[model samples]
Target: MDDTEILSSSEQKMEDASTESPADAIAVTHSSDDSGDSDSDSEDEAESNHQIETLESELSANPYNYDAYVQYIKLLRKTANLEKLRQARKAMSAIFPLSPSLWLEWAKDEASLASSDNVPEIVKLYERGLSDYQVCSLVYWKQLLE
Candidate 1:
């Protein structure tokens, strides 16, 4: 009939259905799930952070290591650290002009996250990307049109 009544009814049903009290059952379930999830998530974050640090050090040591830059970019993208991703892209672009495919991928990422407020920024990115090419690129132009 009301919140308390409904909760009591539900707890009654749960009590009838199992040997454990409803609160105890919920507590056990949540404790197990929360601990397991947090442990795995922290481990994953640590590992990803470690990888990112290693990649950053490698890039620092050899600024011209294109493969390392690519790996760092990919890792940052995978982790969804957008600010760091932007920095990585900028660093890589400064060291070596991004390939057409790389530019397209970067544009796609920006486009996916673009809001009305950020659309102009994305447009600027596209323009910069296009200007990087020695010749006009139809693929990039089509993407911009879309």
Candidate 2:
């Protein structure tokens, strides 16, 4: 057989063999790569905490630092620090009427963690968002229904 034909035939045979008994061709892998990264995770947490502290100080110095509030909120969200996230959002809302999009994001985040106890709080947030804009937000309405 020509080289091309030979290679094609071998490949076909391998495919057929695998298809005949897929279980035999399956691999069971155990990776230890993630197990060694605990130290790195701690280091990252420390770095994020330092950044949060710095941002907090900036906000304290000038509560009108809009960018700092945004960054702080983003970092808190990334860390899934719910209490801190709530406080950050509250602080920002106090300083500026939160945009519809920000309200939507905050509502969604809270909804994801919502329980029966906090349903009223979520509805209040949606109502507040709807009131913030001169025009009604269809997205907010849709999410509120959901």
Candidate 3:
């Protein structure tokens, strides 16, 4: 067999071996669930907290680390830590005013809050986003209209 064919066949075998049958997977999951251990949940929370702290340290050392900010924001969102998410979003928006994606995400998050008090803030956010992206793309205008 050619080198490429040999590599592909081996890769396919690896993939097949890595995949478990649905029944087998469910059995394993059921066994774990039957253990009734809260330790894993606490461990996961601790790990998430550690990750947030590490990302905060990275951001502190390099405030312009946009990728770090994104990671931090994602972690906050995943944990439903709204307060931290808002702070992170505000900081990132201040640093990256021209980032259309950031603005859109922030605005959408605000919209999700569905608070009457947030209406004005959401409008302001959309306006700010439009200021940077309105002329660049029709999608921004469409979003504004919607």
Candidate 4:
């Protein structure tokens, strides 16, 4: 057979053996491969964090504005911005300490997480509350369950 005919026949044989119609032959993808990569999600996350930082900056301008302080706290928590959570807690508690119910809720959330996994964020939250707030909490008691 001619070279062109031989190659064509081989291609058809491979297509048949693989149960893929010649018209259906398309490339398969592997997730770990960097080829054809996209970064839309990372860009979105950066944009969101930037927006939150802007809001925090605006809210922080008025120290006595307790509602703004709370907005900062909620935004910081949602964005996983630990530095700002600490800062927000400090600024929020400057004239107003965390109420006992709020302290209890935060500690209870920390206490309920699974312990075996290395969850540093949760640990940081617990430590920040203990050291900075001077608010009695259940983080220690929950760890004793381990």
Candidate 5:
């Protein structure tokens, strides 16, 4: 199709040139992943999440910063990553005890996952929702009720 696509394909096949370009080539090589079709890459899922994790790690290493807390919560809400969400919930509950939204979202996500999986875990999730997130709207309550 496009000349750019042909060149990239040729380069990957080691037929374009023996020497590599310095700057954009490095970025492409690092980011393209094994799929070759960088546009459809899934590797960024971990890297994007790692950016949030790195922020939390940095925050843990430093003194308290409210802005960092906000960013952490934003990432927690944005990411579908259960492990990172768990860590963020724990950290938020410890550092910002008054933020009910963090706990509510965490409970909601748990209940959502439980419902999707249709596992026995939903019972525990319902109980957690009751205790930790009583302020969710009627829709969430109805979901948990079922």
Candidate 6:
């Protein structure tokens, strides 16, 4: 199969695994509330946690698993795990220095948390991103401007 086919197959497998029963996948405990919404929310959280674990395991086996890295970042961001999200972004940037998307996302996240003291750090992140992806697209330049 070609690369596209392989990628599609892999994505399909991931989707199937994600939709599997939370009990069979991850053991997430819910409160005493037997309400449907609470149960659904608990299951969703379990699924998200399961996905994060799976992606982290994939990254452990192959640090170059860019798709897994992106998914992991997105899950962390969704859960508002800022510290882990920051760490994941830093690690991804170190591994894929030329990835403009990762760099921009990281810079934007940092910018959102920026203060007078850490403005320099955010600027440094943008500088590093631009140094690697300067000629790739105008998006990076626009991101830097904003």
What tens digits encode model 4's per-residue C-alpha lDDT throughout 50-83?
A: 8777766776575777676666665555444555
What lDDT score is found at residue 72 in candidate 1? 86
Supply the TM-score for candidate 5: 0.46
Query: Which candidate leads the pack in lDDT?
Result: 1
TM-score against truth, every candidate: 0.68, 0.73, 0.66, 0.42, 0.46, 0.67
Candidate 1 deviant stretches above 4 angstroms: 1-38
Residue-by-residue lDDT tens digits, candidate 6, 59-93: 99999987888889877766556677778887887
**Which pairs in model 1 have colliding backbones?**
none
Kindly report which residue pairs in candidate 3 clash with one another. none
The sequence of per-residue lDDT tens digits that candidate 3 reaches over residues 1-146 is 67798668546634642343323333444554554445864675689899999999999999999899989987776555668878998888788764776677667666766578768777888898888765666776676556
lDDT of 2 by residue, 39-73 (tens): 65477568989999999999999999988998898
Better structure of 4 and 6 per lDDT = 6
- lDDT string, candidate 5, 1-146, tens digits: 68898677756744321222222333444555665556534554566668787887878886367677667665554444456556665665565543444444555556555545655565664555555555665755676575
lDDT of 3 at 45: 63
**Model 6: CA > 4 A from native:** 1-36, 136-138
- In candidate 4, list every pair of residues with a backbone clash: none
Worst 10 residues of 1 by lDDT: 17-26
Model 4 spans with C-alpha error above 4 angstroms: 1-40, 108-146
Candidate 1: tens digits of C-alpha lDDT, residues 34-67: 5535675467568989999999899889999999
Q: lDDT, candidate 2, residue 21?
A: 19
After superposition on all CA atoms, what RMSD does each candidate show versus the true structure?
14.6, 14.2, 10.5, 17.6, 12.0, 10.7
Task: Give candidate 2's TM-score.
Answer: 0.73
Clashes of 2: 0
